[model samples]
Target: MDLLIDSFVSAILLVVSLDAEMIAIVGVSIKVSLTSTLFASIIGIPLGFAIAFGDAPGKRWMITILNTLLALPTVVIGLFVYTFISRRGVFGPFDLLYTQRAIIIGQLILIIPVVTAFTISAISRIDERYRKTAMTLGADRIQTAWVVFREARFGIGAAVIAAFGRVISEVGISMMLGGNIRGFTRTMTTAMALEYDKGSFTLAIALGLVLLSFSFGMNMLFHFFQGRSRL
Candidate 1:
């Protein structure tokens, strides 16, 4: 009991002091997560908008596939990407395994479905009049989309934020694809896992605190935007 308390206090102190190692790991985690989220949003948002707004056939099936993918386990994605990037794989000649880019790729695949699903939900809720009104105006196809995007911005923002949270805290892909190389590909989650395995709780506790704080912050931001959108 006392040991746990002490460890947590020490961890908090490390965070307060801005420990260099902790900062580096956090930075790497942020970089990888944000990069993946950015790419996922770029691809997923437009794809989702198309599915929701377009008159394309098989839209229901596409949405089902995307929603199903949202539940895919992180390690499954890790393994899937590993197969392609491993030495024996076709793309292995580029040697992308165990690198930051590898981590981003894994995370990117992991979050694409999440972003897409959320986007679909967001845009689907829009009153049909918004689109009709836009078309009634002088808006072209692209301009109508921009108008819809403005209406759905809050929901889309939440989706992107959720993706950021998912990728930032994930361990399986980071460990499998990144190799958790210290000062390189190591992230807060992977570092905590390594520290725990090494029987060192300081860094682990610190990272846990950091992760909790980060998740809380993201959730707060999500709610804030959601509230504003309602207004």
Candidate 2:
């Protein structure tokens, strides 16, 4: 259709021009996603390793809960976090609502389960003999854990990549918690949503193209690491 073609061309021009608003939205998206992913990895990776290697009772239940949370809706996470941070809510005194920190918190919650589940799966797939072998070689508990983590590094990396993908493209948490304030909290996803709602498809299409390209690159890296893991 002519409209589609025009929109596509306009989007390309917008991207090529590095429009200020577009750049700002993209920057915010990357900042929030990377921050949340880092926090999620910091907490989730260790939690996964602990659950996988430790003899904690009811670990099955813990893992089951985490796995179940992988399917949790983004809006649900946004709503849950908003409840605590919003005015008149439990932690309302902190005034976290509608801020980058609030968006990060929601996104952190969203990706924690993803990273933890993937990490657990990754570590669980490693041969049990590795642990026994490490112990036989006089590796202490800490050293053995380190060895296990090294063996599963690729999978853990994949988990991180996946978490990045999820948080970067998600709109609900960013919109709900960040309030989509232009030049402040607005991100690519939220901007795209706003543009689409306003029937301004050019910018939305541009953001989509950028987001898709980014996700594709991440997937390629994920597959590369996954393939390398087998070697």
Candidate 3:
């Protein structure tokens, strides 16, 4: 108990001191997570909207596959990306393995499914009457999709937040794809894992505090959107 208390106190001091290494890791984490989330959102949102509104053959199967991919294991994603980027693989000439880009790619894969699945669910919940009304008013397919998306904006925002939350906290992809190289691809979750293995709890605790704050902020934003939707 005393050790734990001491670790917590040290963590507070470290954060207060703005420890350079800690700050760097946190910055890298934020940059990678935000970049990957942005990319995932750009790709996933449109795909979600398409799947939600389009009547193409095998659409149901595609959605089911996407839903299943939403639960894909992080380690599996790491391994898959690792194989593609490794020396023996086709893209190996570029040497993307064990870099920030590698980590971002792994994280993007991890979160895309999250963003897509949530987006689909959000669009699915919009009232069918709204769609029928829009079509009746001469709104073409594109306009109808826009109307549904506008109505479902808050829910879509929630999906984005959820994707960010998942990728920011994940360790497997970061560790495997990034090699957790200090001063390079190291991130909060990976740093915490390394520190824990080294029995250095101070940095881990500090990063955990930051992660907790991020999660709280996301939840608060989600609630704000939820409240607005209700209003």
Model 2's lDDT to the true fold?
0.94
lDDT of 2 by residue, 1-231 (tens): 998999999999999999998999999999999999999999999999999989999999999999899999999999999899999889999989989999999999999999999999889988999999999999999999999999999999999999999999999999999999999999999999999999999999999999999999999989977876676
lDDT of 1 by residue, 1-231 (tens): 988998989999999999999999999999999899999999999999999889899999999999889999999999999999999987799899999999999999999999999998889988889989999998999999899989999989988889998999999999999999999999999999999999889999999999999999999988976776666
Q: Which residue ranges in model 3 land beyond 4 Å of their true spot?
A: none
Model 3: lDDT of residue 85: 97
Off by over 4 Å in 1: none
lDDT for residue 96 in candidate 1, whole number 0-100: 96
Off by over 4 Å in 2: none
Global lDDT of each candidate: 0.93, 0.94, 0.91
- Pitting candidate 1 against candidate 3, the one with the higher lDDT is 1
Judge candidate 2 at residue 34 and give its lDDT.
Answer: 97
Winner on lDDT between 1 and 2 is: 2
Worst 10 residues of 3 by lDDT: 222-231
For candidate 3, lDDT tens digit of each residue in 1-231? 998999999998998999999999999999999999999999999989888877778988988999899888999999999899999988999999999999999999999988898888888888899899999999998898889999989988988898888988999999999999999999999999999999999999999988898999988988877666544
